[model samples]
Structure formats: C-alpha cells, structure tokens
Target: MCSFGLKAALLGGVFGLAALPAAAQQTKVTSQGITPTEIVLGTHQDLSGPIKSWGVPVTNGMKLAVEEINAAGGINGRKLKLIVEDVGYDPKRAVLASQKLVEKDKIFAMVGPLGSPTVLAAQDILLEAGVPQLFPVTSAEFTYKMDPKNPQERLKFNNVPPYTDSVRAGARHLIQEKGLKKPCVLYQDDEFGKNVLDGFTQALADTKLTAAATTSYKRGASDFSSQVAKLKSDGCDFVVLGTVVRETVGVMAEGKKLGFSPVYFGSTATNVVEVPALGKELTEGFYAVGGMEIPYRDTAKGKAKEWAETYFKTYNMEPNTQSALGYNDIMTFAHYAKLAGKDLTGQKFLAAMESGDVFQDMFGSPPVKFSPTQHLSATVFLLQQIKDGRWVVLKRDLTN
Candidate 1:
C-alpha cells in the first residue's frame, strides 16, 4: 500500500467474539507468544542505522512500559517479554528479523517496528502467521487503512497520526491564517514523501488554491539547492515538506543559504526536537502539525512532569518526542492486553482494543479510540513552530 525505499521512523467491543472468524481464532488460540509465565511481543528497530535516533529512544520507551507493567505483577500474571531486533531500517533485514521473531521468538504481536519499508516488508510474514501488528512506528497509510475484503487487515492497527491527515490540517491552516497565495511542496521521492505530497495537493484543493510548483529529492540526498531554488523561483509563498529530521533541517538550511525563505511547513514527523537542535537558527519559525505535545520537564505539569522525571532517572538521559511515543505505544498495547484478561488469545486481544475504550497519555495527546471498522487513531493535531531552538505550540486541535 506504500511506495518506499529507506524510511525512518485492533478488533473488538462493538462486534464482540462473534465477529472473529473461527480460522483466525484457531490460528491464534494456541498463542505462541503467551506462556504460563510471560507474554512475548517482538519489535524491529534501526539500532545501527540512520533512524536509530528514533529507534533507540523508542525502544527505551517500550522498555520503560514493560518494566512498569511487569513490576505491577505483569499482565494477569504473564510478564511482558519484548524481543527487539535491529533491522537497521532496511526492508530485507526487517523481513529476516520478523521471520526470526515469528519462528523463533514466537512473538504474539509486533509492537512499534520502525521504518515504512521495513514494516511493509516484514508485515506479510506476521499476518500470514496470525500475529497481530500493533503500533508500528511509521505513520504511513497502509499501517491501518485496510481493505474491507481482507479479514487479516484487522490484525494491523496504528496509533500515530497519519502523515496525510496531519499535513492536510497544517496546510489548510497556513493557507488561510497566513494568507498564502502561491503554495508549493518539496517532497522526498518515497512513500513518506509521496504521502506528504498527496496531503499538500489535497490541502491546496480544499482551499481552492493550486500548487505554484512541486519538486522532489531522492530519499537520502542532502543537497536540496535545486528543489529550494525551484520553489523560490516559482514564487511560492508557502512550502509543505515531506521530510524527517535531517532532511527537514537540510531543506530549511538550503533556503537560508539562498536567502529564499517562505512559510515552511511539514508533517508531524518534522515536528521533532532534533530539527531545532540540528538546524539552530535556520529552523526558527518552521511549522509542522503533530498529535503529541512535546513534554519538556520545565513546562510539563502533573503526570507529565512526573513521567519525565521517572524516564530520565531510568534512562539517565532526557526524553524527547520519540521517547514519549515509544513509551505510549507499549503502554497503550498493555492497556488493551490487560483488558483481554487471563485467557488472552488473538481474538480477545483484538476485541479489547476495539472496545471503544478511551486511552489518554501523560504527554497530552488526543485520546485514542478504536472500533471494529475504524483502526486509525488520533484525529486532532497540534500545529507547532520552532522559536529560539525549541518547539512551541502555535495552535491546537487542528482537524479537517
């Protein structure tokens, strides 16, 4: 469902047990990952690769959740066992890693696997084996947008705000609020980039505006002089980006070098703390839309402050946006797993997820809800900007 090169980055309640098929139940009832002592879940991350920036912190977050869950006497007496593999953000490695997880580790579910290409490459293995894929890191469309004809699609669920939805909200808000006349997009020529491009196009169409120009760069290219120059020459008043951490900073830096600054905007992925830290002054005023609020210790209050303190004390490093997500992903999974109770099977777990229960995180993200038909979570996104080398919220609850 996604076109990719290198990337970074539930059932239930309403339908009840009757909605689950006998074949699926038969395949999962044995629950390979569930033992008398523990429940095994697997994840693949880019520990030794490019996006390890995301993978390492996320893994740390998952560990925190598992530690907390297990400390509470584990989930219904079954301690959580998370076996993580280093996929290096490579699709081939991801497939191999997944095979090991399924065949050897015997993971009942795949949680927070990183990278779009990697997840896509490895997903079929898990699905065919009847292992549930929960909350893989990439926010690409296919992670949750399933074909109704395919029953196995329900086995895949996503929590991160999709790239398309966040971009749409950000683009529309910029055009109207900033009075942008000529909008354009400089996207990465890959799955993640294409999703941003689609969102940009859709946003322009919604505003009854047309794109001034659109250009793309290769997946890992650093020099965006040509793309930036093209957008500048086209007189684009605003430019939507389909870029992650490094590329986001690269594009803006190039624009600064050329003295051609427009209203720069990107998806939730660009709303990361890394951009500001890396880009320094070049990234100031850069805007992006995000679902999760960045929780800084000084600014955070109550549970958020408490969580940050706990995270730092545990990891001996400060938490960033990715850390929060990683922690939330496993916590969210654990929440449903707990609801699944002692006789946790694939169907019961799926049911618990779709039971329309509201999940709220300490980071002040939108409450997540899943249903039999709706798997994608988080409709609201916050529009943020970089000011003085830190991300500041500009607007909240941006929705189409």
Candidate 2:
C-alpha cells in the first residue's frame, strides 16, 4: 500500500495532484485493490453527525446488497468487500478517511461518499491514485463534470440527480403553474446550499422575477426560527429550501408555527421518506424534486415492493429512498464491474461504465444512461408533493 501523504510530498504537490509525474499519472488506473479471490471497495458517510438520517440507512442498504451479491457467488466469482468510514459530514475528516481507504486499505474504487464539501475535498486523492470515484451520494455538478483536458476526470461518474437541475425544474414548474412571484430561499451555508441557491435564481430568471428574500443557516443547526422569520417577513408566497431531512423538517415546522404558509420547495435530497415521516402534518403539501420514487412499502409494486419487504425483514426497519438508492448504487457498480470482465482494473471499470449502457433500478428511478462522454446518469427531474404523509407525483419529465 502506498502512503497518501508520501505520494503528495514525492512531487511537492498539493492534494497529491499539483506536480504528478507524467508516466505515473498516465497509468494510474491499475488493478490495485484486486486480489485472487476478493475485490475491496470503500465509501464515506456521515454516520454520527447531522446527516446520519441518510448515512445509517444508506449503509444498511449497501450491506444488504453486498450480502445478496456474495451469496450469489459475487461479481465474476470474486467476493466484494466494502470498507465504510464515518466522516460525520466533516470535510477534513473526509480527506483523512479517503487517505486511509486509498493508502492503507487499497480500495479499488470509492463509491457513494456523502456530502458536497466532503466529496469535493477528498476526490482529488482518489483521482490522483487512479481509483475511480463512482456514484458518489452528492449531486454537486463537479462530481460528473469531466474536464476535457484531464483523462483522470474520465473516471468520475455520478448516478444521483443534481441539485441545480432538480431544483430548477421544480421551481420553474411551480412558478408557471401557480404564478408565484414572491420567491424566497432558505439554504444551508455550504456547497450543497449554494447549488440550490443557484438553481432557484436561474428559475426566477426564466420567469422574469427576482428573489424576495434569501437566508442561510449553518450545517447541523437545529434552530431555524431566525431563517423562517426572515422569509416570513419578506412576504414570500413561495420558498425554496436547500436542506436535508432534519433541516427540511425544522424549517417547515418553524414556518407553520409562525403562520408562514406558502409553497415550500426543496431539492432532491429532501425527497426522501424522512421528510414526510418526520414532519407529518407540518410538511403536508411540501414540494420536492427528485429522480427516484420514495420506496414506501405499502405503495411500492413489483420488484421494488419485494425488495422493500425483504429489506424490512432483514433489518427490522422500514426502507427509505436513500436505502433503495444505496442498494441500487452497489448493484450498478457490480453490473459495470462484471462487464469489466474477470480481469478487473480501474481502467477496465471506467470503460465498462462509459460503455453507453442504460441502468434501471427496481425502485422506478429515471433511467441511468452513461456514455463515453456523458457521466451524469439523469438530466430530467420529477416534482412530487407530500399529501397525507405520502409523496404524490405532481409532474413528470420536468426539465430546466
């Protein structure tokens, strides 16, 4: 195993990238994590922090997938090993976790690392080491945007619907149908929140309107009174939320207490089951953007329904959107890895992922189409609303 710090210092580079050697950089994607009978993979998620609502269940789903695959003889007859590190949604810790995974664990690929800032901070290390960053939980634009001049970027692929596109589609639809003008935005002060802000701004631009007000809160904050009060005071008839499950519930519940009734919208991250489950009456009629259907066991059908029930039986907990997505992410990885054939390498996996294949999940998500030049899985978005504690699709095939 190569030391991550030593690799950076060897070339006096920053983030192990600034001064990479030409020959080594050209052949970075080798079969590092492959063994005669096993293939090791890695991921980082916020298991103990604010976003654990997402991390815990997502990891549960991944574990379930690994079990399923291993029992079926694994991918190409080699069992899969997933090493998870809890980053607590902290970027610095994310980097250190990435170092440990890449250098010490010698993971072949980094799959489903959580958070926008954390993935951003740690991705260069994975890329520098020639390990592919696949299906990261974040939908930040940089995750899928390949730099034409950098071949290393070709290893990056994202399966999640982007925040910018999802919010833009939902916001635009609401503005057109409801004729809402006094738009306000309450966002977390971070990379994820900024994308939401940008999307809402673009939507307003399309409808020839401007924001009535915008406020931000720090990540992991439990109090949203001030931000809610600010938007309420601005007379916002519609508000865009840049929040995850907890913050989403917190802001909306706070708004209800303050009698701030308006159309509330959120990006894909808020489209999970927790939003409706936690907020209940407070979040009724809340709108959100996403590409995957929230897998409610009672309402899910076909393979999706079966999977949800099996998940509950195995884990003794109800399955959510993140759970379905995490399971799907691993299955998708296996599909491509299998296509990479028995001789698996980072280069082969990259080619397999970019082989113009369309992957569909059991949970009725938008079809994931990956091509040689296109890394983003889905571009179209869906608008859904929480009605009677369940998400109902309001519109489909929405675009920016």
Candidate 3:
C-alpha cells in the first residue's frame, strides 16, 4: 500500500509540472515595442517633399504631445517615445521606411503617417505584423474599413472624418444652402481623388443633380491650365476641388488668370493655413469642409485660445488645423493606452479604443468615438470660408 501511494503522488507531481507552461502562456503579455519604462511608436512623413509644409507642422505637433505626456508622467508610468522617418512623400520610400520601423525599430504602432498613397503602400506590411496603424493623417475611407475575411485589415483606425463624408457635407451645403448649380470637379487620378469624387457624385445623386463638368489630373502635376480651362469653358459656377494645398492654389490661380471667378469648394486637405499663406489673394472666398474646428488664433476663446497660446509658446509658430490634428491624434492614442492599464498590450489598446468611449480633444471640438464596426472617429464636419485672409467658420456640424 505504501508503494502504491508513492507512485500516485509522483504521477500527481508530474501532471502539475506539465501544466506550468500552459498557465504561463495564458498570462504572458504579447505586446511588442513596449519596455518596462518606455513604449515606442513611429511614423513616416513627407519631411523633404512637396507636402513638407504640412508634414513639418504635423511632426512638430506630435512631438509636442509626446513632450507634454511624458512630462505629465506618461501613460501608466511608461514614457512615450516617437520615431519619425522622412519618406519624401514617395510610396516606395514609405514602404522602405515602414519596414525599418517594423523590423528594425520594432515600433508598437504607427501614428499620423501622412498622405493616402504612402499609407496605402505601407499598410499591408504593418497589418501583417499585427501592429496598430493609429490615426493616420489621411482621411481615406479604407483606413477605417474592416474586412471580415481578413481580420488583419482591422488594425487601422482613423480619427479624421473620411474624405468622402467631408466632400458630401461640403456638396450638400453648396447645393442646398448656397443655391449653386452647374457644379464641376477637378480631381487627381488617385485613391484620394477618387474618394472625393465618389462623395461628390453620391451627394449630387442624392439631390438628383448632375455635375456640369469633371476633369482629372495626374498626381503632383503643377500646371492646372487645361483642367481650369475645361471647367471655365463648361461655365461651372461652383467647382469642387479634390486637390491638396499646392494643387488647390494652382487651380484657383489658373482660374483667376483666366478671369474665372466661380465659387470654389475643397475637402479638408485644402483647409490649412498654408492655403491662405501661399495662395495669398487667390485663396480669398475659398470654402472647405474640415473635420475639426478652425484654429483661428485671433478669434480663439476658452480652451482653443489656451491651446493656441501654449502651441505658439512651445513651437514658436502659430498653430493650424494640421497642428490641431496631430496633437489630437497623440492625445487620443494616449487616452486609450491609459485605459488599457499598466499591463498594456496592442490587443488591449485596440479593445479599449473599440469600446466606443468618447474622447475630448484639446480644441474642444466635437467628441471623438470609435467601435468595432465604426472605426472612423469623426463623421461630421464644419464648413469654413477664407474670409479677410483667415478661415471663418461658416457652418458647424454639417453632415449628409
């Protein structure tokens, strides 16, 4: 009987030993880019390219957020570190930069990567590695859409209103409120342009109206003579621009040269301080649909005034809408990261984000929220016009 009892005890001990690894596996944290004292994040931007004007301020804004957060003790005691790469606004270069960030740097996530084409080129690589692409600067709808068959596509989340929705809001305002008919479109032949065109077309369809003329241009083309001529010839009284800052200015200037003075509408891409600064007199009376509140320094009050003041003191430059966006993106990420707790993981952060909790930004615009199905944070936008050399808020919370 003693011998039998000894054998049974030995068998029980062996079973317990076998279960140890399974228990450890169940509790082991599966997060990357996290150290006991630091969490590493990275992004690629157009630091030396055509859009550097937009990229520089955005990078600065993100850095400012990192500084403020780290100074305030960071998220759950882990300091945040941001690594930025210059991609020159090129897709191939963006892909290469993303590979380095993922493979060499081993970043936890990507925040505020600029341009739709660049993001599209690098998205698959990051998604395949299960890294969260958080709050990319582009508002392309694909940034937030999830594919049920491919769960990896769910890794991307966007804080800005999609380009489609922004265009739709602008179109609705122009057609219904402003009494503008004879609409025309000048769009780039790319995903960004296509999304804007789609929204404009959908909005017109909803109103049973048709665009008078539509023209496309190659991306990064400087001269807008032909496209502007086509719209002018079509007698387009209201033109929707699917162009970025430079293109927006170029097209409007070309129109001005030809003495065509139709009302111009642009997506959030054109709603930057550079538009007025670079375009000068030509940008006057231009209207745009923006996902966030216009960061007008002179008219700012309350939280926005304080934010602008702090931003100016920190960066030695006035803040624009892009700056506001960058600051909001990092703050939003940190908020969710904090909610994920001290034992943070990418999956936990994602779950916290998908919990549909509303986040208040520094500018006191509308609260942002996300969910499993709805990954885009802001669906509504405000319409603003460049009046007297500054962006003036014309309408708030315009939606289609």
Candidate 4:
C-alpha cells in the first residue's frame, strides 16, 4: 500500500473491510474509521473556475477544518483525508465528480459540492452510496426536500437549513420587526429563487401580506432596470430579493438609478462579498438570515474563535458565511467519523451522525440536531446586515 505519511503511521493501521487481512486491507477499504490512521472523504467545489466566488473560500475553510482536526489528534487518532474535485457549479461535472469520488477515491462520506444545480445533480449518487453528505453549500429546497412525487425522497439528509426557512424568517422580520409593509420581490427565475419566494409567502400568509410587485431575472443577468421600474411604480416600501451576488448588486444599482431607495431584504446569499461592496449604500438596510456568524466580533469564542484565528493564520483572509459553513460541514462529519471508531463504514458513520451527538462546534449558529428522519441542522439562523462594508448580526434566534 502507498504510504499515508506520519499521521497514518501513528494511528497504526489501515482502513479495510472486515474480511480483509491487515496488510491488504489498505488496498481495498473505502470506509472511515475502519482503519486507525486515515478517514477518506469526498467533496466537489469550484476551486479554479468561474464559481470560485464561493468555491475558493469554501474550499479553504474545509481545508482549515480538516487540518485543525488532524492537529488535535484527529477523531479517535485517525486523520481525515479529503479528495476534492472542482465541478465549477456545472451539473454534469458535479455528477461526474461525485461518481469518481465514490468509485475511485473510496470516500466514506461526502461534503460540499456547492450550488443548487450541482447538488441536485450529485444527490442520487450520494444517497445510493449511503454515504453521509454533510453540510452542502446550497440552500435549495431540494437539497433536503421531501420528494413529493416519490415518498423515498424523504430519506435524503443534509446539514443545510431550507432556503425557505431563511426567506420566511427574513420576510417576517421585514414586516413585523422592521415595519416594512409594502415589500416588492425580486428574484432570479430558478429553483433557488422559487424556494425563497415560497418561504416569503408562507411567512406573510397569516397577516395577508403579499408582494407589492415582483420581477424576475435570469441567473447571470447584468441589468435590472425593468424590474426596478416596476417596483418603483408600485411604491414599494422594501424589496426582498432571491438572487446571488451579481444580481443582488444589479438590482440595487437599477433601483438607485430609478430613484427607488427602499430597504433591501434578501436570501442569505446577500451576506456574501459582493452585496456590500457593490451596493454599499443600498445594501445598508439589506438583511439576510443564515448560518454563519459575523466575523471579527469580540464574543467570538469556542469553535468560532478557533476558526477565526486559524482561518486567518493559515489563509490570511477572513472567513465568510459560505467558507464557515463549508468548514463546518466537513469537520462535523469528521467528528462523527471518529465517533464511529475503527469500523467507519457508510452505515456506521451515518448512524453516528444521525445520533446528533456532536453539536455545531463551528463558530456560527447553534448546535445541530440530526436523526434517521432528519439530516438538516441549525434550523434557526441569525439575521445580519451590512454596515460600513461589513456584515453584523442584527438578530439571532434566542434559542441558540
């Protein structure tokens, strides 16, 4: 077998199926904790391509988490070994990458593989392999949505909260908390946008509040003048958005040009780098609810402190929401892989994860809760807004 370095040697054994001899076990085993030295896992990201907007930082976050775990003597003394492939948010590439990770890398679990379409592509393979997929980066409902057409879809598990969940919370806060009544809706016309709208509707269902006007844009659209005009004509008091960074800025720019200076509310994606940078003045009142904490806060402690220090120390960049979330996904799974202990098959690790023993040890959000029937974690989210080119927490679920 190929040498797995000093960390592997310290753990004293190789991962293999129960039937294999120790010498040959390393050659064939695909499960984690089956060996003392290493736990193999897989992930897909947009490391070197167009989607690197999120892929680069997210990948770095996962790397930092894995490195930190290994330095801390690993889970049960077994170092995590991640095999990452970049899919650039392309669905076909994601599917291909996922297949290779399962068939060739022999990973015991999966993490990341960002973007809604990419995750949607890789979903079946992960489920069929029975490998635990922890904390994917997308908020698409289908990431953990119950299959309406096929009852079996409920078996899917993910650590990400529903996109709708955040949207609902944001909408409610916009109405009840922020006192924005006649809100307009702007969204990209796709699965992610639809989910956000669905949540917004559900939040105002009881109060009979609805969008003053709604306009849709394609995912990569660079212009939002027409949409902004509609909202302006409708006299919207606020505008809720279901868009990625590019469109978020575009809408804000057009709204500004059209003299529609309404407070902005958006999906958690608004907390990313572009929103505040491109729409500085307009993004001031922009609110988003998501998993990650506001970085550089004094109260940052425990996992948050660790992540903040290590992330900056290692990479020299502040970890963003996507980055923190990506890191959490991998480390939490590694925690479960260790808990499974020396027999880390898919079944064993999945069972361990389902036990919900490890809380969200990362710097953001509350601890997680998982089970056979529930794989999503951090059901609650913190509300944040941009102030002076940075994100700050505005409100948090008191339960955490």
TM-score versus the correct structure, for each prediction:
0.93, 0.92, 0.91, 0.84
Where does the lowest 10-residue lDDT sum fall in candidate 1? 1-10
Which pairs, if any, clash in model 3?
none
C-alpha positional error of residue 376 in candidate 2 after TM-score superposition, expressed in Å: 0.4
Superposed on all Cα atoms, model 1 deviates from the true structure by an RMSD in Å of: 6.5
Tens-digit lDDT track of model 3 for 79-112: 9999999998899999999999999999999999
Supply candidate 2's per-residue lDDT for 358: 60
User: How far out, in Å, is residue 396 in model 1?
Assistant: 1.4
How far residue 67's Cα lies from its native spot in candidate 2, in Å, is: 0.7
CA deviation > 4 Å runs, candidate 3 = 1-30
Best by lDDT: 2
Report how far residue 246 has shifted in candidate 3, in Å.
1.5
Clash count for each candidate, listed in order shown: 1, 0, 0, 2
